[model samples]
Target: MKAGDRIRTVLLAGGSGTRLWPLSRRHCPKQFIRLLDETLFQQAYRRARLHSSPDEIVIVTGSAYEFLVKNQIEELGEEVLHDQVLLEPCGRNTLPAIAWGMRRFADDPDHPVVVYPTDHLIGDGMAPVVLQSVPLAEECLVTFGVVPDRPHTGYGYIKPGDALQNGYRVAAFHEKPDSASAEQHIRDGALWNAGIFLMTPRLFFEECQKYAPEIAEASLPGEYSLLPSISVDYGLLERSGRVAVVPLTVPWSDLGTFAALHDASRQDQFNNVGDAHLFDTSGCTFIHPEGKRVAAVGVSDLVVIDTDDALLVCSSGATERVREVVEELDALHDPTVLEHRLVYRPWGSYLVLEESRFFKIKRITVKPGASLSLQQHHHRSEHWVVVSGCANVWIDGETRLLPQGESTFVRAGAVHRLENRGQIPLEMIEVQIGEYLAEDDIVRFDDRYGR
Candidate 1:
């Protein structure tokens, strides 16, 4: 590495983790969900900070997830600058996402860029290992290859050729193989592709232009809609001659499916992993977000996932096929596939307590100092009862402070807003009476969150 050389970390956070269904949805992906106390995205942010500065780290995600990404980052006690976050108009796959993030460093073509997917689980002390490839970044596009502990068929494999100082030339890139092929690849000393890359902006763009000109061209003007949905491995790395692989010893897992989650999770005495009460369940995994008690009798090698709207019970080996269930749900237009019963908003969040043909009940909580949009419903009228804290309620341009046990009403087509200016969170119970209770009924005159 040179004295003036720089490195930037890019976190790709736009995946809709389909295999971790029920727990992960389209609106709330696995990266934002708390598997432990902290989220996977926050872990990725801390890992990126080890290799680059806060300003040098960039996050590329869809526009719909911008708030969730920002909120998670802020939870780590770090502030994200507007320039550091690149919002894609839509999901265009990894090639376009990486290309868009790489464009921000066009002025500094010599600087090396490291890309990390936000949903993966990686161990600590990765800074030294990641920084080791900085000097190699000048001549080759570097990718980290994990030393596989098992012959797993779920991940792609990377074969290394001519050895370099800290890595090797990428001899070949193999897609996910069957059990026999995975075992053969393991015997041949193939490494698991971790999907982490380190390359200079000049080399990345050059390779993109050489192999994927459409993506390269569309990326320049930010016209990603016209680009093909392809991965960087198939589009660039496999086609480029400058690719190299760095062997990584740090523990890692893609967590692509429930099986992977089971492998990485902590097991109890019966080899079960989860926060549920178990009876005779051996070698089983149970996941419940609501702390509900789940007792199983004589269930072994099974996976049980319970959510508010759906329940999944499958064998441990069948977790990868969870995508089929999501496809079926999408075909039926199930709201469970889009979001959970508890939906997060920019100000706070709301829980769907009950709903029927003509009425809907919700428990709304607004964060301190946060306010809702100044809006009205064309098809509905709302009744709000303050449960705790103080509510700064506005109805038809009239504002008043409603404390605990106070109530207010808003008629249809009347402009209204809710704000929490107190030091604590404002909690309220909202009842809506309407012909149509869908979210599309709102007409915002003004919004603080740019809804």
Candidate 2:
């Protein structure tokens, strides 16, 4: 490693958060949702940018979320090149994701890479700890360890061994423990595994090859699907000898459950932390995402998360088991288990307003200068009524401009497209009559986004 070498940041954002269900789903995870003023991805992006240049940052995400990744980075007013984003064909877990990014930095293996989970939150005190990891990255695989304020059973614990120059050697790695075990670990002065890793590309890839050969051998995107799904901790750090833990002097939370979210968010006098209209509700967190008026009558120590299609009501302590609810929903083939009513796209977003056996209604928003794919639906005919802005509609090679209140009909099997040519967003109501109303029914002729 040289003094002039600059370190880059890699964001591992492919995990599907199951604990934060109803609000988080398979298609849209917690990192992408607008939790506070901006999404956690935005927050993580800003934090990562603090240490690396925009061009130096790499985002490893699932293939389905390629556009969401780009859109979020675009919202930050920074350009994300196509090569800057690594799209996984399917999730093979963190080890593969980090190794894929490390492949890109193979030319300069000594160049440091700071890895962060895009869904986590870190305080300003993390700045010094992160800066300290830069030099430590040259010598060892560094993982930031947070001192446990409480016996948090949700996080993995790190046992510190021999003392290092700036940190400590890893004595052992513990999985999420029971109440008694967690308390014991705290008594032993264990650190919470923060999952933030800083190491050089050569060190990471070498560690992966040594310990996680199955993941390290797969270089192609298609081959990654065949690799076993394993976390970095299980595959490398826990098994490798070249590991060190630096204490993080900052407030941090994985925000993996509703209880953690509640603890992180500011609460009212009643200890509520969401946008629900409470009625005699105290010590309850009501997360009504659709702005539906939720009346919690005399509830305490409860979590009520309401989406347009699903409602989750559980005890505060039971938030960890919410994944079981998602499992049951998946077993029942519930589409609501995967996405919200309002679905996001690269061009913009669309909200499913109504649906029936043969028809579906949607409110679509097209961003300025953005256009939908030039495609034809096999089983659906669509009627679009413009609500705001201007739309340049193309049907069967014929173009027609539609202003607000104007409508257009797209016949079944017609090659049609919708574009927003105006300076503002184009809002339209779409009513579809179809035999099969699904996203996979479209056959695209051309797409600017290379979908």
Candidate 3:
């Protein structure tokens, strides 16, 4: 691809993915979940990099997922340019995110843009299809239309007109259809709208201004509004006339639900899927907690998800309604539905082992050579017990090295820091007692991970 013709890739990564609930919570969403060897967002990044340079790739994610996105991208061992990660204070869905990304690239008139959702699984060679469609993006807004393998009612359908040189013009766009209509659509050569879009930034904004003036006006404030909580398809794609579809015969799965995940994943002879330990089980999807075992017995077509603090058991077919359950829990202000037991930090992770009204127990893991910020708590005192590796602990003005099985105390309002000077991962158990045990009680003096 020519540098002048190169298309900048925008990854929309802000969804909470409530459908994959229990395993995918609000704090640590589905994009960060490891499907194969890497997370879904990482796969999207890698795929984007296959067609565009690192500098040309941009990620738009929620403020809460900013650290998770940064850490995952950084772990790829590439120098990620600053500001490439745009943080949204909250999610306003794809249109606002795409609008923000378009505004960022609108500075360069020559650069085309491709907007893709992060939590999709696509074939390896689909990058060339995106690259090939960039030249024609000026005439028509291009979307990848996956050839329907089955009559999938969960996906939108695209009716194709006469074939162009590289693809076909989209005659009509259909929302998720009923089973009979979906089957008829498959028979009538309707393609699955894969949510893969390619267009020039100028063209995109112009079309938004022309057709979706509300969204265009929303973009003018330079920030997304909380109102109009709708998706891009309902707001733009259904109303736009200048749209084209490129048929791709690739092995792809959205993996948006447990049934889809099970269908996309490999299964053993007993038809059990995932890395979880399955015993005496047939046709089960058991997703285990990381570094833990999830053993099932005499189960079939069951979806068992094991997290540190919560466990979910449901039929695979009922997974699509999991978000409703999560929503009900959220309505009740349930913390388990909001945050996972293991919270990912930029430096490492901390898992909650136990908690009470006045005390909390946590298992903290610091990566090699990583350190926590020099900070003080207002209402809490902590007792740190080194579990596996060496820990360089700083309390008030005193600094000491604590090996495995050693312990230290940090009083409330006293400055403290923890570091892993050793080559191995630092594991420690932290017990806190206080009037308040919330995460916002910390006052940071210095942070290496940019907090």
Candidate 4:
């Protein structure tokens, strides 16, 4: 915008959601997973485009997911600029994340910044309604509230005080209520805090100064770790008197849990979603996205999720307990809960086909013009066979260009690197022979990805 346009969008894609895990993990978040034709992050980007220009939208994610964010945006056929994506060093809740976004307008503190959590499943039509409320953001901290369709205990509630410009003043803010409190809030005309906000940095910082001075002072990413991890709701919105709530009449779901995903997704007459051969299953959600067929019999209101390495089966409405399951897995130090068999990197991705005590096999793909770190393993020697495309291999001081069906070997303690210089992706199968065949056995002499 030229000066005084008063609108910029911030997309919070750094969040790791385990509620829809196996598909959504620490390495691959909910925003990157494709439950439909497009990912939820892409949907949020499209919604942002309806109101602001591509230049006006700022994407905030962690350093680990930087490539996932960029690659997915490119898959949409649009090139994302390097400066457009902000890499937060760590997860410190929405308060610091929002502060990180609004800080972009240090000189233009009066400019309104609209924030959206990318995990939300919002309909396309809601963009126009959001555009209509941009003017209200100048004077009040605007929060887009979803009118409660049902008594959902997971979300925080907001009670409207009085009528404002096409919205209402926030009378009270309620924390995540229980079953009884949620029903009472629903009956009292409270809105579910959709976690969407529109406000200028001036107003936001002023509220932060009053409510959370440490957060206000700790604006830079390096100082972000020092601030207490808190949501914008607890730190600012509830205490700020200059807050307003706009009822979002759009079809929306936070998609925070598998049960919510099932509710929002398309279902058959039996109310079933996903790949499953069912005989007597109704209101059960089974996800077999890998094209594997699963059989279900005489089960209702159950959630059966099957990934290559993990399977989750639980009651439908009790999907919130998946977090507890994750905690238990973490307590056991199981790596399966953190990532899938396939892990994404800036260059491409690698899938572990098989692993044993003495041997491991992996299928690795390198994007064109991308290269892995110049590194070597201490306890393992790797044999690489090119399956397709061309590979530029560097072992020790020797470098050679290998084509499809060619093979190469890198002895243990020898510096080696793999690069794809061809137009197509270089696909290769790697077999490792070692006593300790672990990922941490690598010692990088050099890396372009800053690992």
Candidate 5:
């Protein structure tokens, strides 16, 4: 398969990123977070684009993240030709997602797809590296291996044997090891297993058929019921003999934890990282709000994250165990664990500022030239106060234009749509009051972002 004819891209973007704690929740994971202004997903998308065209790229994301995926792709200016967003009803893990994406491209036997995790941070100028690996991709299942900078027990290890044309034969794949074993593996020249795989769509399915028949069988259309929640590593790569490794001497870090975030993020003079306003901090990672001030005097190697409703403070090394806090919150049925106070949607974003038994106040931001779906609620009435920019409002067969500081009201069961007509972000304060106030109460008619 030629480089241009065979190469395709698959972006796996389904993880919840629970370990990132206050900054990353179920609704807004680490991939969507703007770590240094560019999201991890966007970076991954850019990297993937360097190897394949927009039409050849496939994004596998969960139902809840469909809008975010679409919006991000739009922001990347790739939504014009191919709608690459493949929405999964639910996340069954990497195996099923990969199977689904490969099956989509199975009709074309020549197209080889490179599957990438959307949350990884790779080195600068990765296009040449990816382009160089394309020829090797045709013959074998190529996995990119990061040259281990340290004995990181947080990542898996790859053992390479004989050298290939542009890569090496994969001797074995090792799981996350204990401190001793990890250190030994590092000393023995094992590379960090960066879950980046390149294989033909047909070869991917063929390997699934040989090594992971369960996944292969489940890949059939309308056969999602029997799919087991398994990762691609366990289901295919570990079992496949056709696997190869391409060692990359690149600065790469899977920003999965606060510690990893600290390591990957750019540090200041005081060794502090992130947007948090810090005072007298030497080695701390802070992700605080814009107007919020966080003082860290004489503190080092600490991770501080402050959101609207939750605050997390943990030692940098202990960030791996932060998932336990999410699990604890899950056990308690806490909404904070599932979503932040500021919730994102396809049309706009809404932040719950204050709430009471009968009233709820929210700050909403609608993108310029964007509009909400024509919808109506059965249980709540809404009061919208424009904070900035102009809005074109439609309410119960009446239309009006509202500017900054202007307000409008929609009674319960009234149809409405708030549109941003101006060239700036439309900001509004929304107050809803009635018997019930929930997202599921709305009935959408026409949605631009495809709800």
Candidate 6:
């Protein structure tokens, strides 16, 4: 009962979607990826802000992503508490995630909690719809379904059985189907499951007790790894006869693949999306940073994703098969597909500019008022050069503030750390030289993040 005190919103931020890979990986998933106006997780927070206060929102993410969630929330102009974002020791899918997210709302049984997957992309200003459906949620588990403009084979389908007070009884829930099956499902008056549910702790636990008692009674973060992984659609929604679906006429997309991202975004006359110029190519999507021009002269119906470490060029129809490539690479233990070149840390982030056997170069950025842990490396010595802002460096027993253009050297086995005391981000160039340069070589004395 320590999490969702006076809460109304539960935003699920778990899952590592591989369909948009090269950009999405194990540590950083699609929810945290920068899309249209902002990252999908930020967009979900913006949407959640419509119905609840910052303190009332509960974000559930993996233990490794706690800093990411904190950094993002701080960027949104509000400091987040450690409890606001629940940490999952391991993933147990939606059934356990939702049940655990609803655990701390025991003070108020009928307190309406709207659950949303942070990876979804929905148009803004849809809070009034959830507010209007509160009465229905009090009676039965209310799930939102979007009216599909076309037969979308990627999403699950929901069939409306009979009309309820403000919604309809869920007749049947079908998993993702083939193109032909998807068309038939749409023609039979089925709606695309939006993966958004609104219910209370009372209703949710009651249904879980009857259907999935293991999920209903398990303690999360400790017992989460022991539970079986299953989605809510199969474990609860399809089995519960009291479930209802509310049809929403809004632009909602999971953006599970690059093609879906292109479909949801604004395109050009040639049906191209992102900062890309097409000479003969049409119906393609390119994802890259600005100032980096990506041109396709003689290609068509392809998706080009350019990153610092990896590039993916495949047919637009082959977007769904991106996971296969990731799986193949993962089976080979290819390190290129795990994390991005820009690795996020508790303080800020660091980008590996170049690396070799005996030496490595990095560009580190510490956010304003953030500091690295006091630690020492046994196998490497580091040289820090202040590039943009002020850096408060502590080496051995001496401490000094190095402004821009100043530099310092830290010998191997010396206790040191970097801090940003200025209002702006601290930018520095680090050159590391030694016999071995691996992350595990560091020995921490103290860490604010409890790493």
Candidate achieving the largest lDDT: 1
Give the higher-lDDT candidate: 3 or 6: 6
lDDT string, candidate 5, 218-306, tens digits? 74436664688888888888998888898898888888888888878789998788766566677888888887766766678888888
TM per candidate? 0.97, 0.96, 0.91, 0.96, 0.93, 0.96
The local lDDT score (0 to 100) that residue 59 gets in candidate 1 is: 93
Prediction 2 TM-score vs. true: 0.96
lDDT of each residue in 1-451, candidate 1, tens digit only: 6623457988999999999999999999899898756888999999888768898998998888888988888779899787777888878789889998898887888889999999999988667777778888889999999999998998999999999878999999999999999999989889999999999899999998999988777734357777888999999999999999999999899988998889889999989988777787888888986658778877899999998778999999899999999999999999999898888888888999999999999999999999999998999999999999999999987889999999999999999999999999999999999999998898888998777
Backbone clashes in candidate 2 total 0
Off by over 4 Å in 4: 1-6
Clashing pairs in 6: none
Clashes of 6: 0
Report backbone clashes per prediction: 0, 0, 0, 0, 0, 0
Q: For candidate 5, what is the TM-score?
A: 0.93
Tell me the tens digit of each residue's lDDT in model 4 across 87-185: 888888898989988887667887778899999998767766666676788779999899889899999999998998879999999999999999999
The lDDT, on a scale of 0 to 1, for candidate 2 is 0.87
Error of 2 at 36 (Å): 2.4
Error of 4 at 318 (Å): 1.7
Please state every model's RMSD to the true fold in angstroms. Answer: 1.6, 1.8, 2.7, 1.9, 2.3, 2.7
Q: Worst ten-residue run, lDDT, model 3?
A: 219-228
| Residue 207 displacement in candidate 4 (angstroms) | 1.6
TM-score of 3: 0.91
lDDT value for candidate 4? 0.87
C-alpha RMSD of candidate 4: 1.9
Which residue pairs overlap in candidate 1's backbone? Answer: none
Write down the lDDT that model 3 would get.
0.84
